[model samples]
Target: MAALSKSLLDAKKDKLPAQAAEGAHVHSSGAAQVEGDELWDKLPRTPADILRHAIKGAIRAFTLAYGARVTLAFLLRLLAVLRKKDTILGALLAAVRSQDGPRFGAFFGLFAFGWKLVSHSLREIRGIDDRWNDFVGGCVGGLAILAETPERRVSYMQQMSVRALQAIYASLHSRNLVSIPHGGAWLFALTGSQVMYAYMMRPETLPSDFYRFMVGAARVPDPILRYNCTNVRQGQVDPSIAVDLVRRYKGTADNLARAQGMSATPGVIPCAVIHPTSDSCAETNLSRWLRVFQMIAPVYASLNIVPMLTLRLKHFLTAPRTLASKAIFNTVRSSSFLASYVTIFQLCVCLHRNLHGWVERVFGRRMADSRALVFLFGFLNSAAILIEHPSRRVELGLYVLPKAVDSLFRIMVQRRLAVVIPHAEVAMFAAAMGAIMSFYQREPECMTPMMRKLMRPFFGRY
Candidate 1:
């Protein structure tokens, strides 16, 4: 009995050191974890620390935004060299040296600085952090738009307003408070109708760049469109103008003869005038679509790839195959959309010409080259928006909606139907930015994926 008791005591004593070491190890881990948390907490606990962090963040934002802007500019200039015949290396160098190139960076940095300064100051003053702080901070921060060119301030305002409105709608959508089934398609159709009508009848009312884009997409010489528009306005077609245009574009013999023989009475613009190079509208549309796709694919590819290479180098490096595949897919998709847009628009016009005789026979009246027919064809072509991915439809609609509104606004003002409000763009920008930041901090999930990706560089985590 005595030997057994001594053996048990020795066994218990042997376990004591191992248990002590294990407890010490756990305590050490706990201490390290607490220290790590303390380091994190130290970052924004004091005024000096907050200021240091904000400045550092602002600098980082500037670098990221500036680098992105410069990279995009270089790529665009390179495209210009290839497509638009811009001077090669000189244009690139000028892009780098351009004064406006750095303004985007300054805008981003100043906005970050202002947001941090205001939000943190509010927190300290109120002894609490809340959504209101973010709203106020964002409004104040948005004034940094002044850092951009006066012309760009309005563009920025319009884009941000659209995005903010989208965010707000998304937030409401989450709770089932509102919904718009197929809203993107409807919006695109509605806005696109106005845009195309303006392009045909009142090109001068459109923005210069947008006007140029339309001209290119239509694949028609500007002189022909201008001539046709004038005829429509004057309620008389001048065959001489069409003949001259066909001659200028090196139209086929049949087309040239057709243009020369057109009646002075009002008539629809001919397919020959729209696609002067080919006799058959169907063949021209098919070939032109292929050509446009080839031309536009490279531009969209650069747009997608350059941004990834510049901003997300780490991800690109980690999974080059995946990223490259995605970029290529997106490029093809976007290029297809643009190509289809052009093809469909021209096709609609050709179809209208083909069907006009049947309609006149049925109604016993000529359509008479009315602007209303042009508007109808324009509206019909918007069906091409369906070619794009459904997810991107709303984004595309939002993008074009502002341009349409701008055109309509100008038309209204010119006709004395509306008055311009001074500094309205500035006010709209501030308010929209406030709403954006509030949604960003409080419910980032409400923002579109692209918008969230865009804001992440400057705003960081919610």
Candidate 2:
């Protein structure tokens, strides 16, 4: 009987599936069962895997969307360069040739004529101030005759403001003007000077108080400029009123932060140009954030400036007006001020938004990762702001000054100013773009998830 039983058992063991045996062993002890279950849970499965996939998918989507936006900006700039290529190239060629020709002599003669036109126009414009008609007329006439052909086009918008006279001559007759056109001699010279002023002068050369006033005035919308002007004249006496103004502008920062999915911490200023004077208006978090921004700003600013220097040099040499060159110059020049202004303005606005929340009696939500993303978003938005500001008008005046003077001297001496403006502008733009890209790449992880999600719809699959 034992022999028969043993034979049956052997047969049953042989017939049993391998999986079944393994399962039996797995479930035999409580510890083993728990361990087995854990192992199974750790392994990828349909639902959890789907969730993980979704998150990754979202990130990819956002990245593509951001990339597209950047590309679009670049494309638009490229289009501008294409449209302006002739003017840009002509300017370069003129700069190079100015080093060795009678062109310098003609340019100086034109510069003097342009200066006279601008002075006469300024006196008339400043006196009237109300009749834009006359101002426009004079500007048009001056621009047409004061500047040389290519420089005139560069200063097409400014015409021949006296401030621009030097720059125009410097740009055109780097060495000397061998030839000067007869049709609009004065207008052309003035235009050249305008370009010089816009491209050469530094911030320190500007009237500090006037610049500050302009900064303040920019805050007042066009519709309210007159009303605010009156209010200032009357010496209106309400601290709360000023606070309200600050608060209103401050809302812009909150909107920006929310758009980026950053926490809108209460009573914290996101950015500001003017430092806070009153302790009553202070928020600790905002103060700290400002400090961090201030610390990093110099580093970024330095990086950005490096390219600007290169662009300046390049323009001095080649003077090409290709899409690449324009992009570099515009990006660097605009970004420099934009970075400073946005940092200050946003910080102020964030503070105001936070204070408003505090006033509303809501518990302030701390930013995830302490609002690290906010900093990055502010930085990016600054690029757009820099591009749009009216200060560019002033910058144009400054940028052209040194070059115009140099050109004037060369024309008088029959020697080259030995610098190229167009190539320099282009190089500056390229360097700025490269630096910005670097900054963005360093913080790829900080990009918001929503931005990623929006990108997904476009990429098809990632």
The prediction achieving the highest TM-score against the true structure is 1
Give a tens-digit lDDT track for model 2, residues 78-154. Answer: 43355685454554444344422233223333322332233223323332212232233223323322223544333
lDDT of each: 0.77, 0.35
lDDT of 1 at 169: 89
Clashing pairs in 1: none
Look at candidate 2 and tell me the lDDT of residue 440: 21
Candidate 2 lDDT score relative to the true structure: 0.35
lDDT of 1 by residue, 1-462 (tens): 334434433553454333222212222256654543343233253567567767877897888888888777877778678776787786778778987668999999988887877776665555445578778988998998989977788888988998898888888899999999987888888888888888888888887876997787667777888877876777577788888888889999999988887887645667777677899988999997998898789788888887689768898999999999999998999899889877888887788777767766775444545667766766677787787777688888888888888889999999999999987888888888889888887677888777877778655752
- Residue 360's lDDT within candidate 2 is 41
